[model samples]
Target: MSFITDIQQRFKKGTIVEKLIYVNLGVFILTFLFNTFGFLINYNGNFITDWFILPATFEGFITKPWTIVTYGFIHTQFLHILFNLIALYFVGNLFIQYFTQRQLLSFYFLGTLFGGLIFLLSYNYFPAFTDELDRSYLLGASAGISAIFVGIATYAPNYQFKLPLIGYVKLWHLAAIWVLLDFIQIPGNNSGGHLAHIGGALFGFLYVNQASNKKINFFDRILELFKVKRKPLRTVHKSKSRKTKPTSKSTKADYQKKVDVILEKISKSGYDTLSSEEKAFLFKQGKK
Candidate 1:
């Protein structure tokens, strides 16, 4: 009872990443319980799982449209969920450091949505899958996890992660290996899964490219919340302080100048050569 109570409290106070993991874990346990009940009752199938796992064909999909996102929550194999939840714990935490909770959820659901669509398309279009389409279905959180991993790597390719035996490696290097493995595994047993992974990776790449070019700053909303709301004050006998403050355009121009200078240094000397201040400044501007 104490253990369950502790989990409930943690769930209440935890961040979005923890909440997602808990939801996935809960669903996994429920799935096995339902399966066990079905087995005891002499039932052949668990209609509960079928309603959530995505189907490859259009007819099958139209019946359960919600499976596009729900399938990410169900995992039958222990090893499958183990790898996915581990990856999510590390990469999802890294993701929230730079992006908002809402944005992370967006990337996750959108990635799953895109991956499912790609799987459906591939299964229907390719000659090899024409016979398998009727019997085919997709499951797992790999697509969503791939999106979060590749998304961060695309946003900051030079970012490094330290591995036990291999030392430090650039995020892009890991992302490249991830995509490459999926590509080479296309001829293997889980071709649909691989194709879905590529789709998620592609979304992550394209999304970051477009977002960086547009200079979108989702953190501005968060920053706005911390600002104190003070009433206007009357000037004391019209002092020099009465002058109007610099416009937003000028402020933005100044920020751009600093960013340009830092970017120049990175280009000339590499990101690793940057001082702590410069690296901090780059990260700040990136979120903005």
Candidate 2:
């Protein structure tokens, strides 16, 4: 009980990205355990899990419209969820550095929604999927993760990551490679999933560009309408004498000089070279 309470406390205090990971992991574990139990009893588990996967056919989709979003949270394959969670962790961390938590959530759900629409359209209309449409279903967080990865890469094309063996690679290069792969794989097996990835990537790229220019987020406003309002907390304060240190122009200049030095260091050595204190200072400056 104490262990569970500690974990719950940590989750509550964690960042939105961490919370998202926790939710995905929790769902995957529960699904896996349930499926294992079914397998032990010689029963087919897909009967239970298939309800959460978005069907390719229009008739099937109308029956479980919620799967369009729920499917993004369910992954039966271990490697599928593992890779997605890893990408989400890094990309989501970087995304939150420049965007709000609400924006991140919006991008994720919106990406999933767009991906499902693309999947349905392609499966129904495209000649390639005519035979397989009735039996096909889509599941996994790849679409949402692709959106975040592409969105951040588009927002900061020159941002560098020191990848193992690859040395240094620009953000755009990584995003381009992923997009290109999806584009080339459209006619191959799992074409629906790849097409959905491309759709999500396109949405992420366009949305971030618009958002960076201060365009309205209609999806965010829609989410706001459903949020419950909380009563404002009342507080009493006691007045106390406190000495405030005034910052002079010289001190401000000195701080700016330090920041410039840190920026130069980052440019030369990459972000990983910075100490925790330096990283925290950079993060604070970014928030401003």
Candidate 3:
């Protein structure tokens, strides 16, 4: 019970990306357990999982619309979930460095939606998939993770990562490889999945470009609608002479000046040159 409570507390306090990972892992575990039980009972378990997977046909999609988002959380294969989760952990961490948690959720969900739409359209209209349309169903977090991976790369193309064998590589280089693989695999088996990946990656590229310029987030309204508003605490003071300190307008000007100085230093010398105190101050300002 204590362990469960501790987990619950951690989840509640975790970042959006962390919470998303937990949800996906939880769903995967439940699906695995149900399938195992069904196997022991000699029953077909796909019927249970199928409802959450996005179907190719428009008619089937209309009947299970929620699958557009839910499909990204359903994974039956161990290796599939393992790779997706690992990509998500790294990409999500990188994404949050330049953007807010809300934007991350927006990119993830909107990317998943776009992926599903592309999958359905490709299956229905493409001559290559006409025969497989009726039986196709999509599942797994690949699309969502692809969005995060490509989104961050698009936002920071020059960012570097050091790998064991590859040494140092630019972010865009890795992103290009991923996108190229998806494009090349479209003609092979699992074409629908690859197409969906391309769709998600495309959205990631477009979304980051637009967001970087306009500071717009499509998911903000939806998130706000569901957000729980906390009531402000009321404090009663018995003293009649309680005085608050008056903040000078120069304080704001001084803070902005300091921020500008730090930003200029970052542009000239890179972020690593900033002192710890300067970094903390910049971070605090960013939260505002």
Candidate 4:
């Protein structure tokens, strides 16, 4: 009971990245439990996996639309969840340093959606994948992790990671290698999954570019199509006869300047080198 209480407490207090890891872990255990229960009942098919894993065909997707996002949390194999959660922990923490937690959620979920869409489309349209459609169901969190990884790399192309053997490598260079591997391996065993990875990577690249005011013309316009319209909050400003206060534009300018400085520092060094105060300031600003 104490152990379970501790876990509950940790989950409640954890950051979004940590929460996501916990959710994935929990789902993984539950998935196996469901499989075991089925096995005991003389059933061979795992209903949890069947209903939650993203299907390759449009008809399968139509029956289980929620799988688009749910599949990101489901993992059948131990190594699959292990690697995914590890990537999510590192990349997701890096992501939140430069982006809001809300935006992290956006990239994660939208990445999954786009990845699933690509999987379905490729299986249907491409001649090579047409035969594999019935048997090739997608599962795992690779696409979301790829999006977060590529998104940050796109945001700070010059950011360097110091590896023991290889010294320092630019973030974009690593991203390029990652994507190239996926591209080259697409024709191998996991065509649908690799295609989905590319889809997520594209979203991350295009999204960060568009958000950073770096327009790729047609691609930027296409990203704009993903924007969701929410009801605007109508605020009525009254005439003030009192002393002058800093204008909103001026405040925004100051905030943006600070952000630019922090981002520049991140580009130079890495996110880990930031002082606690700097991290706090960035986190505070990110929430806004």
Scored by TM-score, the top model is 4
Q: Model 1: number of clashes?
A: 0
Q: Write the per-residue lDDT of candidate 1 for residues 13-48, one digit (tens) a residue.
A: 998889999999999998999899999999987765
Tell me the lDDT of candidate 1.
0.77
Instruction: Output the worst ten-in-a-row residue range by lDDT, candidate 4.
Output: 229-238
Q: Candidate 2's error at 92, in angstroms?
A: 1.2
Distance from true position, residue 223, model 4, in Å? 10
Q: Which candidate is the best by lDDT?
A: 4
Following a full C-alpha superposition, what root-mean-square deviation does model 1 have from the true structure?
A: 9.2
Q: Name the TM-score of candidate 2.
A: 0.77
- lDDT by residue (tens digit), candidate 3, 1-288: 999899899899998889998999889989978888888899876554868999999999999989988898998888988989888988897777666777778778878877888898999999988888888889888888888889878766767777899886778889999999999988898888998998889888877666445575553454455462211111111232434432788987897788778765653444567799988777666634
Kindly report which residue stretches of model 1 are placed more than 4 angstroms away from their true locations once superposed.
Answer: 214-288
Clash pairs, candidate 2, are none
Task: Give me the overall lDDT of model 2.
Answer: 0.78
Each candidate structure's TM-score, on Cα atoms with residue i matched to residue i, is 0.78, 0.77, 0.80, 0.83
The TM-score obtained by model 4 is: 0.83
**Per-residue lDDT over 83-171 for candidate 4, one digit per residue giving the tens place of the 0 to 100 score:** 88998998898776666566677678778877888888889998987677788899888888889889888877888888899999988
Better of 2 and 4 by TM-score: 4
Query: How far does residue 132 in candidate 1 sit from its true spot (Å)?
Result: 1.9
Residue pairs in clash, model 4 = none
